[model samples]
Target: MTNVTPRSDIVLDVQDAVKHYALRRRGLRAPRRSVHAVDGVSIRLHSGQTLGIVGESGCGKSTFGRLITGLETPTSGTIRVGAHGVPIAAAHGTGTVQAVFQDPASALDPRMTVRESIAEALGKVAGRERERRVDEALAAVGLTPEFGVRYPHELSGGQQQRVCIARAIVDRPDLILLDEAVSSLDASLQAQILHLLERLQQDTGTAYVFISHDLRAVRQVSHSVAVMYLGQVVEQAPAEAFDRGLLHPYAVALRSTEPRILDEGTEHVERIVLTGEPPSAVSPPAGCRFAPRCPIAEDHCRSVAPDLVEATSGHLVRCHKPGELTLSGVARADAEV
Candidate 1:
């Protein structure tokens, strides 16, 4: 049985989470298969910290976000919220989970005013107090009360996202799933939203699962970063791992693409570039899912899978030859995390 013991500071705990969606049979005799959206993924997030999940499109990062938010149930494994490790039934509940999705235009209701939208998220608050809380949330997101009377169409893109943020925080949830929350906004607006998220975290101590394809944005907000590929984590480490060093080849290639990670006017000594897109999740190849695209792939990597092994303190990588590459990191491990 899973431990599920209570941990005071742990805000969210996930163990071997697997979410698969079965596909319809092509014919009566066709073998059944499922899309392996999120396979054997596990991570822990503490209060007031952000875990940034970065990966290319169709890599299942969004699906993982859905699992954490309870929007979709995992096909297997456990997701326990609140005081970490506490069994869901035997635990005290402070595990309010909320989500701020990518597009604010479609996310907000066309009919409801800003205050009304925020008040709805407050659930059962009285009229007067709901109004107060709504106003407060607006203020927290740097909006004025005058905007509250306006409809979704009346607000600009940035303002609409601010309303979305207000809705997520109006009830003061313990965990917020920010799934590409700022991706739709322009660079200036994205900076504003990112800063706003940080300020709100300081004020409310809300833990965040910030899922994005934008590695640059992820680095700005994450305490730790996890890179996913074809429904599995290729590497997990502290955000400093970007500069301090990354182990997995996939992670290295992803990092090299980010110009900001390199110093201004200085060429990176170990820039890795990989070709081709990720294979389909429905029928990913055997062994490491990243092996086909990995520049350092060997016969062993193609035929045999590698476990996510701990390399340094709190840094885990899934690769057959994690240490042999020019990626820049020492890799030695005896056990899995």
Candidate 2:
């Protein structure tokens, strides 16, 4: 793993961000209820760093990504890019924040050639300058200028994704939200893309918000990791903390299930099989959204929501019992054999 030191300048800052969608009324008589897709989520990303968000489906990971990229406005809270605050009504695809979606096929317009797609992101730089910028963007992602004339259908999955990445960075945005950017590719291809992203960050000092359900991929790419449940962050820490040990019950349980950990034969770690589906976000549990599925829940945990407290240096967790529990982490080589 490469050593990454986050700079003092915060590239992205999100505070108490919330996004809700009201469901259609049944026959216009039933009381309308809303899906709390993203509820009071707060996170920060620094320049040349990656914050990986991991959770089950419908956990608001995607919604949070949308909020950062200005694809969807927050119902409440603030999103700031660098020193400037992002407006709720800001247009997507034109901000200092850009996004590379999961499906490259759908993300790229079928009618547009690779050159046109990348050039469009350059804003008003036209004529010879625009062509030069387009070529430069393509080269940044390891693609040749010849690929400019090819359409989305003509490229492989990996090449199409590279094009999407090029488009996102052509404008030299401060931050780029990658919503499951590598999940759709094969393992080998995923590694290649991950390496490419790391190189780009090193060269351009651009930050990334990497959202994915694949914990292994998250672990591989993120400088920090945030665990979300029921549209709220349950735990967050430096990636090293996850390999050492986690404080929250939800985070510990989720990490134990990763195949990499299991294959390594880590001691003292039991496979935790959580029961019951996550409760509806429309009306989540009164306290700790994870209390319903938590194995170590207590009476206090059931009735009161836990605030995010720093249990260790830079490790934040929302749990009634923060440091009282000792969980197993990935075993070191000496301990493994």
lDDT agreement of model 2 with the native: 0.86
lDDT score for residue 55 of model 1: 97
Compared with the true structure, model 1 gives a TM-score of 0.90
Off by over 4 Å in 2: 1-8, 27-29, 86-93, 261-269, 323-326, 329-337
The CA lDDT of each predicted structure is 0.85, 0.86
Residues 1-337 of candidate 2: C-alpha lDDT, one tens digit per residue: 1134533568788899999998887777788889999999988888889999999998999999988887788999988775344443453545578889899999999999999999888888779988888988999999988999999999999999999999989988879889999999999999999999999999998999999999899989899999999899988999988777778888877876666534454454557778888899888899888989998899899999999888888899999986444443333422464
- How far in Å is the alpha carbon of 104 misplaced in model 2? 0.3
Error of 2 at 331 (Å): 8.7
User: Candidate 2, residue 313: CA error in Å?
Assistant: 2.0
Best by lDDT: 2
